[model samples]
Target: MQRLATALQIEHDASLRTLNTFGLPAVARTLVRIDSARAVRRVVDHPEYGRAPKLVLGGGSNMVFTRDVSPVVLKVEVRGRRLVEERPDAWIVEAGAGENWHDFVAWTLAQGWPGLENLALIPGTVGAAPVQNIGAYGIELKDRFESLSTVDLVTGRSVTLDARTCAFGYRDSVFKQEGFGGLAGKSVITHVRFRLPRPWQPVLGYLELERRMHETGNFAPDAQTVFGWVCDIRRGKLPDPSDVGNAGSFFKNPVVTVEQCRDIIGRDPAVVHYPMPDGSVKLAAGWLIDACGWKGKSVGRAGVYEKQALVLVNRGGASGAEVVTLARAIQESVYGRFGIRLEPEPVIV
Candidate 1:
């Protein structure tokens, strides 16, 4: 086991093929494994790497590497989990940054915690959760986020950030922001805490979950059952990255105003649109791509998933450049048809 302040083992020319869920080919010139907050500080204080450009690599479930990485790769492997506090109103749970998101959700359910059940089966690490503001089945990480501990790369100072400080937005957070006061690429998250409220309420607002209830005749299901349903739903809808090299939901659902949505509906009455509480409508990216006739289509080795157009899959031997090219084409077509620019969900490196 590597210690925090021990001399770091820096691997050279490291292959990132298996590290990323997309299974894209790429190599890092220099890579360091950070298993603790102190390890991050140690790297920051190191004479050689203290000032070098850094790239924090998580599960790589939400990234597209276009070429070989030039920045120093910090592979976070911090690990720990504990029930921080049990209150009458809620249970506060903490997990290390490296903990697998899905596994953590299942662990919480196994321990009788229920809030995270709606977010089950989502890939990536707990650390990357805040960066992407990950959400599914009507629950976003911000809904249950307490605070997170991160060490600044420049100052080597550790800070705990609350939800407000995180500046969480739709599929975004301060950590993902590179604007004023943003922490993007400037710090490394070491741990995250989640507050699960008592008197658990199952989030059954999503349509697919409702459909599952209708089909199974199990309307009032428990958290464990909901977790199982989510896993089943995702498996049926999204392709497994293990079987096929791909990133899940390559594009974010485009949100438009009610008026804009009405315009789109006027053009295509069958457009799938969901109304938001804030008067905006979220158009299904899959529907938009499928409407553009991109489903099951291929450009070189990169192709739109036959089952779900939102996902772009690598048929075989596909380069990251090809994936980006296909994504750009899809974006252009969708924009031309709907007059709404679809944003990509994954970070393109």
Candidate 2:
């Protein structure tokens, strides 16, 4: 434990705002920051601390800490990247879990790697990306996901899990579920590997992206161009944490039955829906929030972002309780009005 303290910052009552984008003023019981996997394993396996619950933290961009965190906080700082293998059309790149996701994308783009260009500017770490299966502009993390290595907290053993074993689907993974007594929260991700396309074709499935590509006349946009467009769109639409604290897209788009969607559409022809392959329909969570008149609605310091209804912003001097309350109100209102319950995208810690 003393060696662990010497290797990293072991702070008591650390302000969490500096770590998380939500800007909530919460404190950690024991925050341990580690820069390498070796240090991470060392701290977890320390004999002095036996069976203490631990929380794995990354960029803290996509999570909302609703209260003072229990257990020890393991702030992953592992960082590095290198091309492990390459083919004519693609390369296998391994990145430390704590590496900034956007920086990795930029680095890959500069090196002429193309698969991650469309995912540019997303806030968080490489480790957190796989947990959410993050997607944007018609691309998903799983599409390029090769595998990842995680440290099993119970046994202090490192394990490598492939794509199929990950059980990734719609922003979820095996780590998020529990098959045993209650739920197990004892796994910590250490690193992620991505199998990226080399001469990548920019995905243009999102209508906004297609429109922008058309506007630029770069019909076959390369990685840089696609990256630029994604950055532009994200910057213009999403609120920067520095200016207005927020977790992008507070709720996921609810996938409902076709019959349910058809009933809603029958009542209002303008109801927007995206057809899914499994005969379900994805309804716009933003539209439902806007319909409930929650967009830009403020309660104390928490409010729906003025620009994007799907995002909840912290306007300074707000408690986590206020934000959660506002979110619940919005959820209840949407369910009452449309018979659909909006699910939050950010993990509530």
Candidate 3:
């Protein structure tokens, strides 16, 4: 770890509390920010630190490091943008993984690109988008994901993986699975490429977005209008982590057997369920938590967001343990009430 500072300013005693949205105070053993693939390779291939575990980090939005850092923290700072390819009506934009996601979306909209408008105002970096297929307002990152380029730490070589190779699923990609080094301090995402639609129709399939569009009396919506609507909806719903610490959607909507959903719905017909193609049903995790009476409840410094049950906020100086404890209590209560165990979406370290 001593040679880590040669590649970048390796900061010890770095307060990661500000880095993460959770605002949980923790220390990193060694933290280095890499601006290029060469710098990443240098740290990963160092013979002195042979086989030591590495953690890759981006904007530090969707993670909860419950304890002090365990391994080296390598913040991916690679940044750039280019028009990789263009057609008569569409274009492929490539950006460094570390680029701010909202900035990229706004840039695309300014250029009159239409596909990314629905995903406006999403938190995190472009590099982390492909991992979870980040989505909102009826559009997902997978809808435009062309390919992603990454550097393999073990071999210190670069590789470009196409969308199919990415293994994208509902809020999941190959990089997110266990043993895939998807967690922080493990694998670095260097660059991301997106294919944008030229004359795209505004997706207003989401109920709230649709209702807002109707209320605005917009019969025919364009990219900019849709982007504005999305930004408005997100701002009205999700609390900005900068002002109030929170990771949006603390839990993934649990997918369960169709029979399981039917059984639960029989008792409470108002329970919402989305039928899946795989003969399963997706239950709204937020609805389940609200039903369990955990919404707006606070314990210590952590509490469920008063407006959105899916978000858990750090009202004050909450420790990671307290947040996790509150989350566990919600999980247990929901399970006890509905027999469905909710799983957290963000990676908790």
Candidate 4:
């Protein structure tokens, strides 16, 4: 495909190594950067590309590409952020789907918004957050979500969907679902609004945060303080992609029933687990992998991060298949020992 003198930026046989955080090698046959909502409509109307399958990409922080892509890659580059409204009870903020999530959180704090403090330093774009229902410490995006606007791929129609319409769950949303009425691959999220509640109380529920508070001898901390602490904690634990390639956490913390939790506890008293409000138990996947003696272990160029067992890092020039292989071996071992299946957090492409 040749470039046309149009608003859309198109590239054929685009190298995806630098695009993905893991630095996995892959190529897109046709890659188009969509800077605005209108770009999506234009894509649907393109002469040669119209009717072709599409794959939407954000920061590529949460995806692992194992092979070259055949679908047209729509790299979302939409940008903007603003204060939507300020009520007595809460403050509403809106951000483009393509905006860097961590930077957006920092901007909110600089503007005196406090609700997103716990989620500070998380990777990926604001658009990907809702799709993954990204969470950290004690708060999930749904806890602060207001609504989002998206453009339909088939009809090029725009619509705003509330939390219910998104059907958010643990690291999932309607955008990640593909059953009947599911929105995955059928729409492009252009903008997302977050509802930051007023009179913010610090979320010190997580063990690491509590340790930080105790070590600092400060029971009460501000939002910026919390933000700094979260960033520090993340930096110390997870390897920076600029230094070492990684896709953050590798697996979702599996949630099991209370009875099932007891069964695991009976076998291993030292298993790291958290009790949920609804009587379920969330087991730490990192702990499970570490207990199985997989931390700092490697299969080819892909290895688990020594500092944080949750992260799988690309040691030098690692391939996506190596990462997947390492992940599968960890899963099989964990299932053999704990009888719990670990689901990968990254989208395997």
The local distance difference test score of model 3 is 0.82
* Candidate 1 lDDT over residue span 164-234, tens digit each: 99999888888778868988899999999999999899999899999999999999999999999999999
- Model 2 Cα lDDT, one tens digit per residue, 20-58: 888888888888886776666677667744378888788
Reference-based TM-score of each model: 0.98, 0.95, 0.94, 0.98
For model 3, the superposed segments whose C-alpha errors exceed 4 Å read 1-6, 180-186, 277-279
Order by lDDT, highest first: 4, 1, 2, 3
Candidate 4 lDDT, 165-254, residue by residue in tens: 999999999999997989989999999999999878788899999999999998899899999999999999999887899999999999
**Worst ten in a row by lDDT for model 2:** 1-10
Tell how far residue 91 is off in model 1, in angstroms. 0.7
lDDT of 2: 0.83
User: Model 3, 1-349: lDDT tens per residue?
Assistant: 3444455546776778888887888888878777888877887766644377766777878888788885778787789988888877668998998899999989887876668988888788899899878977667788888888888777778898888877887788888876654432445789999988766767777888779867989868888888888888889978998999987889999999988988999987889888876899989888898888888999899999988898999999998888999999999999888988888888887
- Candidate 3 at residue 116, lDDT? 92
Task: Identify the runs in model 2 with alpha carbons over 4 angstroms from their true place.
Answer: 1-8, 179-184
Model 4 segments beyond 4 Å from truth? Answer: 1-6
